[model samples]
Each structure stands twice: as C-alpha cells, then as structure tokens.
Target: MTQSGEVTTLKGESTDQIFNLKREASIYYSDSLSTFNDIKSAFIKSAGNSSLQMVFLLKGKLNGYLTGSKKACLTFAEQQHNILLINEKLQLQIKTETHEAIFIRIDPAFLSMYIPADHLGYLNLKDGMQKNEPALFSGCNLHMTSEIAAILNALRTSEHTGFCGKLFLESKILELLVLQLSQFELRKDDPAVRQLKEEELDKMHEVKEFLMNNMNQQFSLRSLAHMVGTNEFNLKRDFKLAFGTTVFGYLTDYKMTLAKRMLIEKDVTIAEVSEKTGYKYATHFSSAFKKYFGYLPNKIKSGKLSLLILIEDFSVVFENFVTMIP
Candidate 1:
C-alpha cells in the first residue's frame, strides 16, 4: 500500500499496498488514508485523529494487554477494537502471520458530528488512556455478526471489471458503513446513534476501491479497521448507506456475474473457472454456481441458450440441475 501518512515496516512476512477506490463525489470528503500496512503487527502507534477502525484476521493472531495483564488473543475470523483518548499514551500489541485486513480513515470532525459538545461527559469517554489496570471494556476484540462476516467474504471477491466496477464497489462500501453505523448504540449506549450524513455516504467509493483491488487476499474487517482508522461497525453501516446493499450481497453478485461471463464467453473447464474465481473445491463451486445462475456450469458452456431464456426456462430445468451438482 502507498503511504499517505507515516509508515513503519516490521521484518516479518509483509504485504502492504494502497488501493485507490473510485467514486463520484460532491461534498464533505476528508483526506485520503495517510497510513496503512499488514504483517505480524504489534504495538500500534497513536493516530492523530480521534480514530474509528475495522480489524479482522484471516489467519494468525493478536494479543492485547495493559501494563502487566495477560494477553487477550485474536485469532482466525475474529475481530478486535481499540479506542484511544487524546494526549494519553496507551500500549497495544498486535501479532500476526500471513494475516490481513481492510481499513478506512475518519476525521475527528466527522466523529464529533455524532457526539455533541455537551454529552461528551455522559459519554464517559477517555481522551488519554483508561486508568484501571483491569478494564471494563476488556472485550477489546469485537464479534462480527454473520451478516458482517458475509460482507467481509464479499469484500474478498469484489472486482473492478466494467464502467460500473467502481459503482458496484462504491455501493458495497456504503452498505458496509450503514451496517456498522446502525450499531452505534453498542458503543455510545445512547440508543440514539443518529443516521449518518449523506455527504459521508460519498466515502463509500473509497471502500470499494480498497476491496476491489484487494479481492484476492483474505481480508478481515478488524484488520482493515486498524489500518484505515475506522471500525467494523462504522464500515458496515456506512457501506450499507452508500451502496444501498450489504457488502456481501454485492460481492456475491460480483462473483456470480463473473461466473456467468466465464460460462458464456470462454470454454474454460468448470473446475478451472471455479478456482480462478477463488473457489477452492470444484464440487462446491458447481453447487454455488448453479444456485446463482440456474444452470450447470457445463450446460452454460454449450452456448445453447441465452441467459434471459435460461431464466425463462429455469422453472423447468432448475430443480433437476440443483439436485445434480453435488
């Protein structure tokens, strides 16, 4: 990833690059990501802004401890959260191997919109660091909902293939944001985390850029949240709003769309096509493939029917093929 901010490198296995997501914008955009990385990471430094982040681990681990506490572990498919107050030093250690994440950055001004000037007290927020050695918000790692997991899976398969490639990604990003923002009550506990600004919706394009470019790598939401300075909740919520669909929904369709294209435009073997599209097993790929396209991958290769006609004829043959894929 290209560094827009200060960046440091650790000597372990490293995969770092920047993705420039595309979207049409009118107003209320913030600065692009200044920093990002993915590796066996530990001890993240403080960001300048009051940060929001999303972190997910596809593999390897994370350990969080304060002062002299035993480590809180993050593992495969798990997510974690951390919020730091202003001017206070906090120690956080992250460790990983062949792990990855996707992230978005939000300015403090953007966050201030959610928290009013007066309620900052009842918010009981910290600026520096938590004083207690044993913490109450000890569950620093988050639990991603199934829906959130689906979206992350989708993010892993997004593609920038057409004029609307960016458009597809833009919408997915927004959907992710909306999904996350809907849960503000979890953090604020105010029961009134209001709707996000429409202008904020414009940032969905940035998210799309990240996912479409990084589709091949296994990406977890929490890992990304840390890199970009936003959290899983915010990404999901804003993504929903910006895209008008959940992240996974868009990704599912994108992958299936490519499958359909491969079925029609080329003579690649069903197994080859499946693996190329990132499916590991041909049998499972065939099942998922037919479920999406209403025909066997082999049948589609024959060029015997138009896609529209296949849908029309689906009522008759779909039931038969669905049973045969396995």
Candidate 2:
C-alpha cells in the first residue's frame, strides 16, 4: 500500500480495510474500548498516502511491502527503527506471515512534538553502518537490542506511576533514535557529532518529565528549548543521551508501564488492561510482557520464579543460602 518516494499524508483512517491504531489519550480518557479485538488481524492493507510513520516490532518477522506488489520484503524482527519514507503517501501492504507483531505506527505530526521535524524526512533508514544490514534480529539489521533494553528497564521502576513513566519512555525513544542512527553510521554515513553541553543535558531530563506528565496535550521542542533557553537540537541530543532513550520510546514505555502496573495492581483482566495500555489486543501484551520480564503476569504474581530467569536477575537468590545451626 505504498508509493515509496516523496511525501506521505494520512490525515485519518480512510478505509475500513485498515486497522485504526487506538491511541488512548485522544478520547479524553472518558471512553473505554468498544471491544477487546483491538490488536488482532490488524491489517493496514493498501495504505493511503501518509506523511511518515514509525513502526516498532514487538514480535515475529513482518514482511512489509511498499505497495500491493511485493517489490522487496522489509524484514522486521523484534526491533524498533524509524523509517522516513518519501512519498505523497502511497499504498502500504502490511502482513505478519511469519509471526504476528504489534506495531506502534505514529504520524509525523505527533513525532514532531519532540525533535527537529526536518530530521524526520532527512534521516535514512535503510543505509546503515552494519554491513548488509542483517535481517534477523539475531543478526543486527535492526536494533532494540538488549543493551538499550537494560537502560530502559532500570529507568522504569514502580514509583513514577504517572510522571516517571512518561519521562523514562521518552528517554528510551531518544536512545532508540540514536541506536538506529548508529546502525546507519555503521553502514553508510557517520552519525552527527553533536553532544549537548552538560548543563543542557541536565535540563533535557527535566523537559522529558514535563512532557511525560502532559503527553496528551500539544507540545513543541522549540518552545520547550526557548523556555529552557537551549537549542532544540541540543535539547534533543542531551535528552537522548541523559535518558539513553528517545521521546517516542519514553511514550511507548510509559504507556506499557501503566499497562503493567494496572495488570499487577488494579487487578484488571488482561484484555481490559491491554486497551488501557494502548494495545489493541491482549496477545501482544502477553508476548511483550514475557519478553520484557521473562514471565507472564500469572507467573510473576504466582510466586513461581524460574530458576533460569531468577539467576539472570538475582544471582544472590541462587548463590546465597541461609541456615540455622541447632
């Protein structure tokens, strides 16, 4: 469903044939899901023109074709990489033949709120530094690697609830942008050499926290930079470095964090909480949770810890033993 060159414009869901990605904040938090089938069989068949989009693979390999005819298959395997396709938006045909995946597709307008909007169209997704850009996630054509994963995990504790969730999520996204650029650097060109001054980096952190708590409303990095009196690009750079993530990553993670907590604390059924978490389906959450936490929710709450995952997370649990001498 894509034309693949110069300009993309998807003003809104144009066809019933396409699955409308459910972004929760829009309904003003007053509306609950119309149904639990939000995440399944989501086929964006024959995508109309779009401005640009960001797709993150949560599981499986998705063969994405630019148009109805499969010119070449885009192999996305459990990675998050943003691509700026130049088109007046074209027909994009998406299908999960290998394994069903959950994708968070965002409009350029929504994305522009955080960074230099020009970079969205300027950055190249395909030409990366990694030779041949390995297709399988195991290979490295894509990132969302465990390294970024570690940084992300630590940033989101149970405390921030509403605020911290947003900050960490944005930080994670910025980190993701850098990682993707690094892959491009590994292949074609070197990434831009711009490091935020130490002080600006400090404020970038504050900006993220502000956005996190207020993501539902409109925002702009330029205005934010001015208010902070820093360059937008610098703020973006430091924001990324300090958080070790990105604006988008922070948003997605923040949403998922709520989903996780709700599942754990609110005692909501997985189906209900999935929608609340911005997931259209529960299967996606199940897969993501198992991958992220090494266990499903029941396993986590059951007090049944895996010997393997436990060792991975807490070596002391396996090595240290206490005994009473009688």
Count backbone overlaps in model 2: 45
Each model's lDDT: 0.43, 0.42
- TM-score, cand. 2: 0.33
For model 2, how big is the CA root-mean-square deviation? 21.5
Residue ranges of candidate 1 with Cα displaced over 4 Å: 1-199, 307-326
lDDT, residue 139, candidate 2: 24
Q: Which candidate is the best by lDDT?
A: 1
Off by over 4 Å in 2: 1-51, 77-102, 106-141, 151-161, 190-326
Per-residue lDDT of candidate 2, residues 233-269 (tens digit): 7766665654446656665566655655555456567
TM-score of 1: 0.35
